[model samples]
Target: MEKLQNREISGKQKVRSAEVGTDILKALAELSPATSLSNLAEHVQMPASKVHRYLQALIASGFAQQDQVTNHYSLGREALMVGLAALASMDVLKVAAVPLAELRDALNETCFLAIWANKGATVVQLQQAVRAVTLVTQVGSVLPLLSSATGLTFAAYLPEVETAELREYELQADSNHPLADTAKYQQHLQQVRQQGLHAVHGLLMPGVDALSAPVFDAYGRVAAVLTVVGPGTVFDADEAGMAAERLKQTAEAISWRMGYTRP
Candidate 1:
């Protein structure tokens, strides 16, 4: 019985140590490219002495380094390797699969995930709500860069050059498009990026409303688009609506899992 109690205490101590180590490591990353010992200790809310001991352990493990001259610390070789390995293993489709479904289930609206391909924002996966809508893009369908909530989300996050040629083509195809003027077009895209999501009424399909949000990767690039579609009246794709909030929340959750952190 005494041995069991001792083992339990030891296990608790190990877990507590692990948590502190992880917290200090996170503080190091946040304070990078380099920070003084005092600053790091303050950031982690620990005494300088306690933080230093952890830093020594981290440095020995190659997860941190201290500059000899400046007495500053930063993430080290092993930390960089671990970060790169994690990023390399992150797959957008695999990461987004469950969240995409949950987003649809939560809102009871059709939801889909789209990846930017050479062809443009293309739906790769979909979750249909029980109630049918007039129309929503199916798997493999390429969305219009200017007209779709999904496509506009991509255009908002992607580099202008990446979509410049396609924009001109889309503009020429539909001279009557809402985003015809260059000023309005740029302004609309800017709004989408600022809000981090967008909603359109019958833009993608008549009588349907769509809400779309961007899913970013570790490098802060738009890795995919998550969109929901339903009847205009029932869906009410207002940026302030329930659907919009859920859509953004789910997208952000997936982005977090993908290692994307906003500055």
Candidate 2:
């Protein structure tokens, strides 16, 4: 029994050491490309002596480095390798699968994720709410460039060269379209960018409300679009409502996991 207790204590100590190491490494990355030891300790909320001990171990493991002259520390080559590997392995659909399900459960609305393709915003994944009898869209369904909250979000973030032809075609197809005027359309796109999300009321379907937000990748490109659909009364409140905030938070978390940091 004494031996067993000792083994348990050893295991716990090793786990704690690992947690501290990771915390120190995170602080190093947050304060990078370089930061003084004092700053790092304060950032991690650890004593300078304790942090210094961890830094010594990190430097030994090639996960961190300290300038010989200035004593400032930064993430080392091994840390870079680990970060690149993590970034490379991340997939938007896989990363967002759980969050999308959670968001659907929280809002009790049909939620779907889409990616920009030659056909425009194409639905790729979906989570259906319990009460949603009729599906709003399905996998491989290509949504309209001007009529959908998802499409407008992709348009607002994606480069003009990729969307120009479609925009022109959509405009010429409908002469009386509200967004037919170039200036007016640009203004609408600007609003989506400024607000970090786009919402539509019954444009995609009658008596339905949909809100969409963009998921960004490491390079800050729009990797996917996340959208939620419900009956018109579901989102009676404006953008500041609980549903919109939840959508924004979910999208932002997915973006962060995909390695995007807002500049």
Candidate 3:
């Protein structure tokens, strides 16, 4: 009878632990941004002490974080990783197919999509122009950050720390390029951020020009860059020109499809 009682107690403890964990996760999912311990306890209908115990476990497991300044709890990096993995598994190319085709037709130039691969921006998709033209870039080409418009678009929107690292690497690698000048390079990036676009003329290759814009993910991070490339004579550099406007519009549309909402 003592053994039977012990088994019953152990089963009850397991059920209680599971319930507490589920309640905490559900409360967190419902709460936006973050919530204080007392408020979370109230929302989960659990005692503060019990909720605190579960929160500590969650924090240790990287499912939650406690803000040091505010003493509130929020979802942590692991939660974001789970969300990103789910998103990455989706068919992004399928979602982008229509907009890419439309942009290519409207601009009458080659269109390409570059994603953040391993360490740099790598071309993943391309829609060729109707008219035959000599194209140097391929599907798997990793673009130079200080030269290609697509790479510049990524540099403009990525987090400052990441951009700083890339800048250092680029400067060391392309010491002879004009963008090696820190002041001028920063000013150029600022302009790209303000305009939500970037253009390069004869930077990547002589007589070649490109315009590019960033596509944001649900987390408001740059997920990819969309670019239009052609001969310098035809690929106008005017910020207010039709091509620029169309490129920006198409990028915004693609960002929306990727679940980015304007904050």
Candidate 4:
């Protein structure tokens, strides 16, 4: 068995390593059905030779696999097994299930749970409404900090230095993809901070809108974000605000349950 070790590195070193790893993971995940080594290297802006080493490591450790004929890299069986294991071991899901279900029933929308990761925001848990429209994305999904309502809400509630670092990462991501512009991204973060909630429409999908609010921990710090998503045809601006308010109240309730108290 390959030993997986977590090395203690400096903050700067961690940033450099995680940035590279995130880029690679994003490339592989985006490729999904089919992806060649060269294609992944170009997507992540890394040399093919260097990326080969990373791929080899991933394959040897069962995080990824190469196709027999097409020579494409896809998520390995171990990756799926690990993902399942993660779901099984997630305490947050167990803790948030009943409350999230209640929130979903109250709002009649799809509820999502996301946590902060070194790369960006990682969706750890999910509870969908029976009558609500389903999202193409699901739990274990990783979204960029700038383009996601949950990410923006988390950033809005983060400390100054942490937010600044996120701003830099967003700008860099913007430079790579024309999908998200830097100036507008800055404005979006500002809106999140000012409004105490985020209601972004047509950002994730063509006809979807999401409203999110921050969930605090016992320390009064943002621990996670709770969001509700719905189709735009059924959800209008007013509905968005109502959902945001409801999500905010639900998040606060969860925070209080976690022993968070404001001075």
- Worst window of 10 by summed lDDT in candidate 3: 86-95
Ranked by TM-score from best down, the candidates are 1, 2, 3, 4
Full-model lDDT for every candidate:
0.91, 0.90, 0.85, 0.75
Q: Residue-wise lDDT of candidate 1 within 119-233, one digit each (tens)?
A: 8999999988977444545799999999899889999989999998899999888999989899998899999988989989987678888899999998999999999998887
Whole-model lDDT for model 2 versus the true structure?
A: 0.90
C-alpha RMSD for every candidate: 1.8, 2.4, 9.6, 19.6
Higher-lDDT candidate of 1 and 3: 1
Question: Which candidate do you rate higher for lDDT, 2 or 3?
Answer: 2
Instruction: Give each model a TM-score.
Output: 0.93, 0.88, 0.65, 0.57
- Alpha-carbon runs more than 4 Å astray in model 3: 1-91
lDDT of 2 by residue, 1-263 (tens): 99999999999999999999999999998888899989999999999999999999999999999899998999999999999999899999899999999999998889999998888989989998887375557889999898889989999999989999998888788878888888999999999999988888889788888899999999999999999988886554257678889999999999999999999
How far out, in Å, is residue 13 in model 2? 3.0
Report the C-alpha lDDT of model 4 over 146-257, residue by residue, as the tens digit: 6778878877787757766766767675666432565765676787767767887888777888888887765678888888888888864343466777787888787776
Q: How far in Å is the alpha carbon of 230 misplaced in model 3?
A: 0.4
Q: Name the lDDT of candidate 3.
A: 0.85
Clashes of each: 0, 0, 0, 0
Which residue runs of candidate 4 sit more than 4 Å off their true CA positions?
1-94, 163-170, 176-190, 237-240
Q: Which ten residues in a row have the lowest lDDT in candidate 4?
A: 1-10
